[model samples]
Every structure is written in structure tokens, then in C-alpha cells.
Target: MKKYALATLISPFLFFLFTNCNKDKSNTEETPVKDTIVVKIDSVEKKPITTIDTVDYNQRMIALSNNDTTGRWPVKAPYPLPGALLPYNRIIAFYGNLYSKRMGVLGEYPKAEMIEKLQEEVAKWQAADSSVTTIPALHYIAVSAQAAPGKANRHNMRMPFKQIDTLLSWAKPINALVFLDIQVGHSTVKEEVSQLEDYLALPNVHLGIDPEFSMKNGEIPGKKIGTMSADDINDAIDILVRIVREKKLAPKILVVHRFTQGMLTNYKAIKTTPEVQIVMDMDGFGSQVLKRSTYLRYIYKEPVQFTGFKLFYKNDNWNDWKMYTPEQLLEFTPKPSYIQFQ
Candidate 1:
């Protein structure tokens, strides 16, 4: 099984791809350029044409990290996982609170309009790589935040069952998967995960743990960022693993969103099992260069089962620059497999 890193960029496909990273060196090989071109006859032209190979992302990154001719710093390939989920795959997801129009596409647009927006994005990704399948998902932030705070006054709030059920119903009609994300404000992963057991039992449902609001100490979620140790992540993994085994369902996907180093602690200790797939998503929104830098610093630097990228519909589009298209994102050595739009 090969461990993979996930990279995702803005709205259109919420696309991300999988690639491996190896931090420690056990073997060495000659480095290769970021991209290699090959000539092939176009079906329509009947003439040989040169095209860049996008599928060799894993190999290209390995070459850059392990073998470098320049005296610059050399990067190391991420550790390989026993197995990964993407074979040049992509996932386009609409993320936000279904209840608040300010949150994401889910609530920003009417149901009909939102569905249309998602479908349009799907079409774009399919056009980019017809061979790969694009999964449409409703990335509902089940638990959101509030200023007044409740019960624990942790600022971490849970979405009502009614709201989640409504979104699940919408996803079902489109044959989309439902991702229930938890902020866990002033709460523990164990506690948060345990409450969602019933929903996790569903075959199409998945999980996402956001460390940004984890509040490792006693800091407020909005006041400052938080962190999650490998242990915290493992607890969520264990819960999903058990659910998958007991239900005899397909492997469950768990996405952990991150952008900064402190958002996630202890990368090496994080483990993946047969029952559950883990994706380390770079959840920051910025310009193309800034986004790429974050990917290199975290997703590539710290190897995980897979990588993911998040695109802010408005935030990423700042500075009058448009969002990154699927074709442009494929330029990365290891393409991101999971993508989310907010």
C-alpha cells in the first residue's frame, strides 16, 4: 500500500489528488524534472503532438526530493501508505453550514441553484480527466460556532439533526456522499465522534475533523487556532474503523483539514487502517503561489495517507485573481485527490 498526500483547490471541482512522500532516505535515484513530455498522435489530427504527463506526479515529486543537481535544499518523498484511494482521482465538494447563508454554497444558493453549481463544477473536472471519476459530496459543517456559546460555552456548537437530515436527503437524490464535519469546540474527538455513531452507520456518510477549533488549551475557537495530536486523530479513526467493521460497509473516508503546522501535531504518529482512509487536507485559502507553498510545507513535508486542498469561493478569489482550475492544479507533482469549496 502506498501512502498518499491530498491537494485541493477552489470551487469548481473541489478537486484533490493522492501522492506519496518519503521523509527519510533509504534508497537514492537520479532526479527527474517536474514534468516530462511525450508525443502521441491526436485522434482528430492524426499527427504526433507533444503533451505533458500529469499522472507521473508521484514520480516527479520523488525525483525532486531525493535527487537534485542544484545545490539547493533537497526534499524527501513522503512515506508510502499500505494503500491509497486515488488513482488520479478527484472529489468536488461544497462546504459550509447548511443553515447559514454566510457559510457556504450549501446555504448560499437555493437548493436548485446549489445543485446546478455543483453539477457545473463536476462537468468541468470530468472534462479535465474523463478517465477519473468525480465524486460529488455535501460537505456540511454539522457543528458550527456561535458568539453567545452554549452548554460548555466552548463556542463549538452542534447542528440539529433536522438540518443534517435535510442535507442528507438532498445528497441522496444526486447519489452524493455526505461528509459530517465536527469542530469539537471545548470538546474531545471521542465525545464528538461517539455522538455521531448512528449517522456513521450509514454507508454513504463520512467524517471530517477540524483542528482549527479544537482548542487544545482553553482558548476560544475564534480568538485563536487550535491543534490535534495524533492521538486525537487516532481516536476518530478507531471509531470509524469499528463502524465500518460492524456494518460491513465500504471503507470510510476521514479527512483532517489543516493549513498551519500547529493545526495538526505529530504527523508520523498518525496511522491509516484498511477500514478507514485518512487525508491530510491543506485547508488554507490564498493565491496560487501561497497555496502551493502551504502544500509543500505541510502536505509534502509531512507524509500522510492522502492530501486535500480547500478553495474559498470568495477568499481565494481575492486580489482580483481567479481561482485555480483543475488543469492548473494538475501541475502539482502529486495532484490533490480531495477538494472543497466554501
Candidate 2:
């Protein structure tokens, strides 16, 4: 959200209420960089990675809760079918759209520089908590909400398949995961997710839906904060379930971003299936206090299956304010399982 960076000039109270909206025009003319090379990991024979330890699942879950006595930290949800990632590995993702540098770190730096930065973050998180492994990820905004209505009269633009292919390539060399984030505007979640069936079928590819730009009431995106009902979230879960089952693939991770209470309604009704793991991400940028308050108010209080936190390099570091370090974030009531950088 561009407005997040302007908080210093405005009232702190008012700034906290504004949604992070990206209204930049989609740059479709740029072609994928075929020569881009991600860092190569050492080629040594290693034990096959286990997504979860069945016998110690509960123990791992408790460890992830970070001694939360609130009873809401380790959500009482069904154990995801084998090959799940949550509660086992903390995902460190860089979020943004390749078309807009202002969107996030994903597009702000050069491919090589961005990957290097993400690797450094992964290492920091690993060092902060050695209990859980850290997995680097690229959270790309595949479907972006637009300021202008397109041919479909929906204020959303879907990036071409080639762009997604490029992101997949970037993940290969580093052994990282990929998350395709969607920001629907004047469109439905089902409509947007259905279009990505091909990509979601892949084991390494996951999903993220942003209710901040949902625009369910037909309001133009970026003018106001939007919302997504439990049904909207369930729609996404349903799609991922079908993909996992039909393809006989591992469970997929679904991330939903929220900074305010209204952004996601009927939280209790959001279903968690064995084929899909849901992460309720606190997607806001501000002082460390404000960010923690927002997480507690919405994510921690709501009792989602898993939790995620986003860091804004420029927004959180504004006016002499420092961003939250991985060690500090680990002190959170229920340590975030997913960490995103914008």
C-alpha cells in the first residue's frame, strides 16, 4: 500500500486505517528474462526432506505456539495430509508484482539482487529460530487490482503465464517455494483462482488471496478497503483441494492477507482441509507496536490455522523507526510461521 509510506505526513490514527493498495498500471510489454540465474545450492546427497513428523506433530505444533497460554495459538484444526509445510518450516517470502516495483521487494530489485536479499532474510530467520527450518519463497502478485477498469470492466489485471513461468524458474535453482497472490477487484475469488489451475497443480506452487482489494461492493479498488467472506476463502480452498486430490500431489498452502478486522469476515467458518493449509497473514506496515497490535487484534485473536507477518522495508523504517528483527518477531505470542517482505 503506497499510503503506508505516507503515514509520517498524516495522523498516525488515520494512517493505520488506510489499506495498502497498489494502483500502478501493469507493465505487460516487458518480456521474461530468460538468462536470469538463481543461486545454486551445494549438490550433496542429503536425506529426503520430511514435510512433517507424524509422531511429533503435536510437539512441533506446541513449539510453534511459542508457549502461548491463550489457547488460540495452535489452532485446533485437522492434521493436514502428508507433505504439509506449516508448523514444520517457516516460510520466508518476498512479495510483489514483477510489473510494479512499488508493489514489493519482488519487483523492486534486480532478479539477482532480490534473490540475494531473500536468501539473507531466510538465513536470519533460521538463525533466530533453529527449531524450525526456514524455506525461502517468492510471493508474486499474479492477479493485481487495477485503478482503471479493463476490458472485462473488472478493475483487475491478470499477469501473463510467461511471467509466472519466470518466477517458477527463479525458485528452481534455490530450492524455494512459490506463492501466487491474488488481489481481486470487481471480480470474484473463484473467477481468479480458477484461472490458475494449471499452476496450482504443481507441488511447489501455492496460493495467496488478498481481501484488501476484493471490492465486493463494486467500489473501485484502491479507493477503499475491501473485504472477503468465509465463503470467498472456502472457494479458494475448494479449488486447491480438487487440484491436490486430482493430481495426487502434496497439500498446498493458502495464505490470506489481512490488516483489519473487516477485511475478513466469518473467520470461524473458514475451513481447513487435509489437502490445503491456510495461513492468515497480518499484512500491514507500521511501527513495531502497531504491527504487533494489528496481529493480536485480528490474527492472534481470530484463531486461524497458521499465522504470517509482513515487513515493509521502507514503510516500517520510516522517520527513524526500525523494522522488526527476526529475533524480535519470534517473541510474538504465536510466532509467525510465514514471514513476507515488501
Candidate No. with top TM-score: 2
**Runs in model 2 with CA error above 4 Å?**
1-53
Segments in model 1 whose C-alpha atoms lie over 4 Å from true places: 1-85
TM-score of 1: 0.75
What residue pairs are clashing in model 2?
A: 1-20, 1-21
lDDT per residue, candidate 1, 1-342, as tens digits?
111134423322111110012112111211123122121111111121233243464554443233434322122323222222343346788887654566667778999999989888877888876755676888987765333345456555666566667777788767677889988867789987877777777766789988877877777565566689999999998998888779765567798988777778887788667677777788866678868987878776777666677777887787776778888876654566788887
Give each model a TM-score. 0.75, 0.87
For model 1, the local distance difference test gives 0.66
* lDDT per residue (tens digit) for residues 114-145 in model 2: 99999999999999899988989999988877
